[model samples]
Target chain A: MYGIDSSPIRKAFELARTIENPINLSIGQPHFPCPPNIIDAMAEAAREGKTAYTLTGGIPELKEAMARKFLSENGIKYATPDRILVTSGISSALFLLFNALVNPDDECLVISPYFLMYPSMLKFYGAKVLTVKESFGTDDLNSFRKKKIKLIIFSNPSNPTGKVLSKEQLTALANLAEETGAYLISDEIYELFDYDKKFYSIGKDYDKTITLTGFSKTYNMTGLRLATILAPEEVIKALTTLQQYTVVCAPSVTQWAGIEALKTDMSSYIQDYREKRDFVYESLKDFYPLEKSGGAFYYFLKVPIQDEEFTKLAITSKKLILVPGFIFCENKDHVRLSFATEWDNLKRGMTALQELSKELAN
Target chain B: MYGIDSSPIRKAFELARTIENPINLSIGQPHFPCPPNIIDAMAEAAREGKTAYTLTGGIPELKEAMARKFLSENGIKYATPDRILVTSGISSALFLLFNALVNPDDECLVISPYFLMYPSMLKFYGAKVLTVKESFGTDDLNSFRKKKIKLIIFSNPSNPTGKVLSKEQLTALANLAEETGAYLISDEIYELFDYDKKFYSIGKDYDKTITLTGFSKTYNMTGLRLATILAPEEVIKALTTLQQYTVVCAPSVTQWAGIEALKTDMSSYIQDYREKRDFVYESLKDFYPLEKSGGAFYYFLKVPIQDEEFTKLAITSKKLILVPGFIFCENKDHVRLSFATEWDNLKRGMTALQELSKELAN
Candidate 1:
């Protein structure tokens, strides 16, 4: 038995799929070719017969490379190989974390409009999930301090809204977690996609914060299915133990490729992504009421019509797919638009949204 | 921040790793190249840019191949493509199944001296694990009937012991589960390694039984990381939800390769494994007391000394690696030896083990 409800992003797409030829924008995956170096490395590994089970945590060389990458990119320090746990992806890491930390009925706090999978992961282990609401423009600091939470999960460049938390905000949250003995699960998978401001992590402040990052978004290696969880020595031990029952390790070849991806120059890819982000932010300004996205490849645009109705109308009239905000438990007048697709595709999709907006206004 | 202690298998291995140059017999992995054809397929997929997120359950073509595979090879019938949830591996499948079936503190039954990971997986989710101890030579049927197990977990061609349950035994257990509303999670990962007899899955008698099988062991594609959980409609729905929080899908490039693996002729690889199994079996017969392994790629041997002391002595006197049996929670006099290595390596390891037995006897 598997937990299907944990995939609201996917389910949202699937539900829209049942409609006549909808432009599905519900899932949050990049639509680009994976980096050349990583693909080459994977092909090499596969051909060389590196197909046996790797170490349960991960390969040493890959782990060492990841350690270097984290230090260079995030300015965080973790020496022992035992501090990292390679995972299938962030999804499996989340499952392992929830299973290990949340004793049955233990309460976990999540900011409202969080990734839908967070609640499902908690619910799968029978952990109590509490939602702390934040207004669309509310300061994250005040919203986060309202409750004593056991574990708080947040994306550095927040999902659904593309709202990046500042370094000070991250440090404040980390302090609160330390004061209350709560753990912070900082998802920084989109660390490289910030257009202007740099992304910050709670892990930089407290050792209790577990940082989840991967090559999926940055290198467009989603199918390679590699991710890592960085935590304190004790948390790493516990998560490593839990991972043994799920994925023994990330794919060996993928981990090898991950090493290459981490080592390569990624500025060109970020430059390309920033171009798309800029194009979407500028193009959508006239069509939809929106908050400017700070980082990541998505725009949380406020549509003129109800989010669900607007998505439906766009799908029917323009073949444009956009995710309604209800999936993330946000107000119904908003939609999440991923700009990870090609700029041409984004142009076409944006034009369709404009046409749909005019028709609804008339 | 992550739950790592939930893995007893890694703990057992980690403990063994502490022993200076300990011979490890604790892993449940096949030691061989993934079939050359499968490797080629993976390389081809990578070359063709099959490097994006596949459908959540899995690629349609792979699921179709799997359906045909079960029908033609295992004589099982199923048509619901939606009922199969492809996983990163069988380990993730088990983790998902526990989440779907076991509520916190609810009971899940496991056969004792079984695969060590089951208890940890159940316990990680806070499920009360009830072990029904089975003496090596005695029937475990009566014990299976007595437990009020909401979920039952076992590996066919049992892990650690290499014992295969008879059809009658499986049918009786299936009938018991059917009567009790228990969902059986049968891990048939080792199904292809059965040498003495064909594997019997509880799925034959109980549609509610969730079957987990993978290419890791069968095709030596462990590093490729492909596995799937087959279940009835309701179980599949729940599992899909659980996997949404765990892993979205098995690696796509690997899944493409796996489809080819299932379609290609695998008799030669199995034939090679059979040879290795026999070579190791006969080589060690004169030195250590061993129960004839009915199936799977291991020789569960009984030693005169305590498992830990024998393991230590073997490591000190010889450069041999063998997994101690106490880790499996069974007869402390026993040890589990994997015969999955290359023929020459198996022979070399066996020779060293034989010399250690003689030295210990003196």
Candidate 2:
């Protein structure tokens, strides 16, 4: 009798799929095929006997590769293999981290216009959630100053909004967390997609910072179900014990593919995402109110009307699907449009959105 | 910084593996290759564009196949696609179920000498775990009736002890749950290894049972990371929402392979496990006092000396590894041995254990 407490993305998705002549655009999946080398690794692993359960932490090769990736690119230093735990995805990492950190009715703070799923994930575990109002690209450190929050989660390059945080903002947030004794869950899932600034990780400043990032956005291997939970040694041990009874380890074949992804030439794909990001930014000028996204695939638009209504109308008439901003937090007048699709689809979706805007204005 | 915890099977395993010429009697991994059909399917999926994020609930094909498999095997009536959530493994399913049902500090009743990881999983979620004493093959329904518990988890043909519940026992427990409003999480991971009786699912009588099982034991595909969560429609929806943000979905490659696992003939693998189960059941008879394990790939043996010390000594002297029983919530004098290794390894490990026992008697 759990009637659809339907997700905002799901609602928009359901409408788009069900409505005839639907131009589905609400989903956050990449349209590109997984790289051949990654897929080949998976196929090769299957042929070999790498089909047994791996250590709870992960296969050492994948963990070491991730560790090297962290060191060479970000200059983040951590103790060997023990500090990293491979998760099913960043989603799984959040679930596992919160389950380990938050007690029922414990206060967990999150930024406003957060990932729509945070409220539900925290609520499901009976965590008392408190949201601090935060605008994209703005330093919102003052918001956490007076709260009794046990944990706070935020995406570095904010999702949906696609606003990357400044270095000062990240340093301030890290310092605040160190002072307040609040564990910070920094979601760096979009680290590789930054448009303007170089990606900055908070792990360098605070050992308590639990970072969630994965191969989905960067490597475009979302379907492979690979991500890493990088934490301090103590936290990693706890996560390993927790994961042992949860997902065990991520799939062996997927891990093999992940290892290959870490070693491959990734600049081209990053460039591809940048191009798409720029194209969508340029096209949205006449269609809606927006700013160019700093990182990640989404373009959070301030729709001309209420998001719920705009989304419905767009699906039914324009045949274009965009997620309502209401799902992320409480930005009722905005919607999130993912530019991770093909250029043609983005073009078609934008055309439809423009028509819908004119009809709403009349 | 964290040393390995003393799990019943793990401790014995440490001892088993520690001996200079030690035999590894611990660890429950199968030596056989997973079905070639499953491997090929996974490779095929990886080759295609199926390596992106999937619906959190699962791929439609696998869910439908699981539904069919459940109906054909268990005669349990349920909706297929609508009622199933494919998880990374049963571990993920259990974690999700516990989080959904048990609030922090709320008492969750569990049978003793259960899976070693259960307490850790519960503690991670801040649940106050209480043990309701359960001995092998004993119907202790009355013990559970007196507690004001909110949830109870038990493995059928339980881990370490490998004790399966009878139809009457399962039915009685289901009725108890209905009476007390307590949820039941049936850890039926050993379903295919049942030797004494046909596996009787509690969900057959009770709609609220969240049954957890996977291919790790039956099909020897532990590393594949594929499992399904079968529940009433309501639980499925709640869990699906959790899974959506957590993993998005299990690995698409694993899903493809799982599709084949559901469709492929598993009788031969089941027969192989049975043979191994029988071999260990008989081999350990002259060595130590052991509980009768009718399912799972473990033999719960009562060591003559301190379980931990004996395990260490055996590993050093005999090259045999057996997991101590303390981790499984059993007496310290007991150890659990996995006979899931190759026949040669099993014979050698057992021989080492025998020699260590003789050496210890002096």
Kindly list the per-residue Cα lDDT of model 2 for residues B251-318, writing each as its tens digit: 77888888787777767766776787777767767777765677777777888887888767766666
The local lDDT score (0 to 100) that residue B30 gets in candidate 1 is 68
Candidate 1 CAPRI grade: medium
lDDT of each: 0.75, 0.76
Cand. 2 Cα-lDDT: 0.76
First chain TM-score, candidate 2: 0.93
Candidate 2, residue A17: CA error in Å?
2.4
The residue ranges of model 2 lying beyond 4 angstroms of the native Cα positions read: A1-5, A77-80, A103-112, A122-152, A202-209, B1-21, B103-112, B119-140, B143-149, B175-182, B195-198, B202-209, B290-292, B360-362
Runs with alpha carbons beyond 4 Å of true place in candidate 1: A1-8, A15-27, A77-82, A103-112, A123-147, A205-208, B1-27, B104-109, B124-147, B286-288, B356-362
Q: lDDT score of model 1?
A: 0.75
lDDT of 2 by residue, A87-167 (tens): 877877887787678877888878777887677878866788887665533345666667667787888787878878777
Best by lDDT: 2
